[model samples]
Target: MPTYKFKYFNARGFGEVSRLLFALAGQEYTDERFTQETWPAEKPNVLLGQMPVLEVDGAAYGQSSAIARFLARRFNFYGSGDIQALEVDQVLGVVQDIINAMIKAFYEKDEARKAQFMTENKEEKLPLYLGMLEKLLVKNGSTGFFVGKSITLADVTVFDICDKIQAMVDFDKFPQVKKCRESVASNPKVKKWVDTRPVTEN
Candidate 1:
């Protein structure tokens, strides 16, 4: 077995997906969590000066989605074939788009512009993405999984993002999306982690 060390901040942010993947796979890895006070000292040593670096046998890799995909493939959380992989990637891309918009609004400096961005997000983008995801889940037979008959990286990724979104807005209108989120959370290992993991404000 490869020795694995994942470094990230105390918050779930981008690191949660990889952590969830590890838990779901029952993989043993060193989770190196930092705080704001500790991050600056450790930042320069990080592979890309970014949190959530996955070090495999002392070799460091950057990018959260890339790390998640690597773990997904290793643990069979990626789907069975090339087409399924593509479908998973497509969902991931859409999730990233949603995340990007949220991040932009989060960091916006102008108060009026921020409010505008947030309003547009709440009224438009959120529904648009949620509806699209709902359709994808339906297309996949609404098995509560995104791509295949079982859990995949796509399902976990979407679940994580939807959970975050739900913190800001209710997802009651998106029943399929709600079911998918519930299914991921209901996984034994994942539920354990969610119940016991360190709490953070992210």
Candidate 2:
């Protein structure tokens, strides 16, 4: 078996899904976490100077989505087959749309522009993407997952993003989406990790 090392910041940001994957799979890996103050000294050594990087048997790989997908595939968290994988990817894409909108709002410089960006995200982007997610969950039989009957990369990604945005977005109308998140959160392995993992404001 290849040894693994996952390097990311102390926060959940883009790194939590991969951590949840590790927990769900019961796979043991070195989780190397950094703080914002300590990141600069080590940033130069990281590939592309970005984090949530995974090292497999000493080989470094970057990109949060790529890293998460690779881990998901390795741990059987992707899906059963090609078609299911496509479905999982579709949900992942929608989650990315939400994350992108959040990122835009998070980085806006002008206060008024930032508020406008946040408003648009809350009023438009979230509803569209989250509604699509809820529909996908319902289409899959309302099993609290977007893919097959069990949890997949799609479910984990949705759960992670929803946890991040729950405070900012109203999920009362998206019951299925809430159920999907609850399903992941209530899982034995995932719950264990969440219970023990560092708490972050994000």
Candidate 3:
């Protein structure tokens, strides 16, 4: 096995999914966390000047989604076949859209503008994306896993995103989605890590 080093900020942000993947896979890696003050000095050395870069045997890679997908494949969490993999990718895309909207709302400085974004997120964006996710979960037989009988990358992705969404919106209407989130969170490793992971404003 190659030496794995995951570099990211102290915050969970985009990197938590990758960390969760490692935990779920029972893979040991160096968790290299940086603070905002130290990031500027260290940024230039990163492959893409981005957080959540994964280094395998000293070779660096950037982009959180790609890194998560790579780790998913490495850990056999991607899926069984091409179609299943595509399904996982589709779920990942939807999760990314949700995160993007959340980030926009999170970073808005003005109270009124932030309120508007939050309202739109809670009222419009969350419902649409989450409703779609709920439908997909139902289509997959409501098994609590997004792709196959076992947990896949899609499940992991959804679990992380929904876990975040729960802070901003109640998922009571999307029972399937809520159930899926509970399923992932109930995993022994996932639960342990989530409970112990560093807390951040984001």
Q: Which candidate is the best by lDDT?
A: 2
Per-residue alpha-carbon lDDT of model 1 for 1-202, expressed as tens digits? 7999999999999999999999999999999999999999999998899878999999999999899999999999999999999999989988988998898999999999999999988999988888889999999999988898889999999988977888665778888889899999999999999999998987
| Cand. 2 TM to true fold | 0.97
Candidate 2 local lDDT, 70-176, one digit each (tens): 99999999999899999999998898889889999999999999999999988899999989998898889998888878999999999999888987778889999
Compare the candidates by TM-score and give the number of the best one.
1
Q: lDDT of all predictions, in order shown?
A: 0.91, 0.92, 0.90
A best-first ranking of the candidates according to their TM-score comes to 1, 2, 3
> In model 2, what lDDT does residue 174 have?
95
Deviating ranges (above 4 Å) for candidate 2: none
**Native-structure RMSD, model 1:** 0.9
RMSD of every candidate to native, in Å, equals 0.9, 1.0, 1.3
Alpha-carbon error at 184 in model 2, in Å?
0.5
Clash pairs, model 3 backbone: none
When summed lDDT is taken over every stretch of 10 residues in candidate 2, the lowest stretch is: 163-172
True-structure lDDT of candidate 2:
0.92
Considering only N, C-alpha and C atoms within 3 Å, which residue pairs clash in candidate 2?
none
Model 3 misplaced stretches (Cα beyond 4 Å): none
